[model samples]
Target: MAQNLDDNYKIAYDNKAGFGKSPALVLIDFADAYFDPGCVLYAGVDDALASALRIREVAHDKGIPVILTEVTYQPGGRNGGRFFEKAKPLSCFVKGQKTAGFAEGLVPRDDEIIVSKQYPSAFFGTSLASTLTAMGIDNVVLTGLTTSGCVRASCVDSMSHGFITTVVRDACGDRHPAPHEANLFDMNAKYADVVSEAEIIAFFRSLKGEAHG
Candidate 1:
């Protein structure tokens, strides 16, 4: 572990992608399917949920755009394709299913943009990139479930789409710890800067000229 975090810092992972001028916060798939304890996809993400809510409140106060993502599949799972076949749990989002809805207390406001997606990457088959680009958003603060899946995909795609990406570590969870930690390390080393929920709140506060990080 030290070999990756401590030893690689000066050479293999020297770069630190910092903050940008304009930022938008995105909560990826904080839906019932992933939060319901009875659901197979549930990852016990209580801490992540609370962290996201806190960061979101700060972001909202700072006038930073808040974007929410939810997995939605068409009838008979036609929109899901291979991903659905691989993970049948995805069927939970089928059309009118209640599990497809956003979890309690995590619903998006009427003003916030909600990206309805059927894939891991929110940017795929969604208008999120163009919307952010139109709003002149140069940074993306990510929060969501299954850190190794949608969160990881969104983080990488955020970078590939030219945004200074920051993944809130405490606001992202996974079914298992290994993949979560591994992906966080990998994403920080290459795609996004992995930061804490408090750090992100500080960043938002700084934007409002309240306090500095």
Candidate 2:
């Protein structure tokens, strides 16, 4: 389903040109307070953490900035009780665990930026847009858990913010495959370039070669 669709897109994009080199990689994850037990958004926790680690490695090697955004839990904030109640039950399952408290991959590097967000869209009520602007980041590679929720929200807003958003299909998963597959399709049709890990890696390699050539 989702993988199949993503594979199709990847095959097409692999034949295209000008994906550009040294594009910034932004990995958004649900590793924060709002996802804690009793607060809601606990499902897909494990997948998020694992995906974060894998993306972190790739981004680090490529010298790409990896911005990790988490949903904060404040009484009346965006991700407070009101929002959770609405979004939580929609999830396939809840598996609350304190995996990545601060950042997705833990112990953030001095150069990396960690954003604390209260809403699904990292661009909302955060300096993410400005940060990306300052860094001259014209493209964003998004990955994380719960493809139907935060990931979708961020991808939409990322597109709105004028960054060419791309969701790494394999690097993102959901508690259930149905919602994930459906949402990824909708997103690809409307906003963002939905691609696979192998495709993205190959694009990065091509970029590096061109930069040094």
TM-score for all models, in order of appearance: 0.94, 0.73
RMSD of 1: 2.8
What are the lDDT figures for the candidates, one per model? 0.88, 0.67
CA error at residue 15 for candidate 1, angstroms:
1.5
lDDT of 1 at 205: 84
Span of ten consecutive residues with least summed lDDT in model 1: 204-213
Q: Which is the leading candidate under TM-score? A: 1
Q: Which 10 consecutive residues of model 2 have the lowest summed lDDT?
A: 90-99
lDDT of 1 by residue, 1-213 (tens): 976666766587768899988899999899888778888787888888889999988988888889999999998899898998898889889979989999888867977899999889999889999999988899999999879999988888889999999999999988889999999989989898999987888888887542212
Stretches of candidate 1 off by over 4 Å are 1-6, 209-213
The digit string of per-residue lDDT tens for model 2 on 32-144 reads 54245653544545655665566667667767777876555643333454566766532322223353354334566787788876567778889998988887777878887
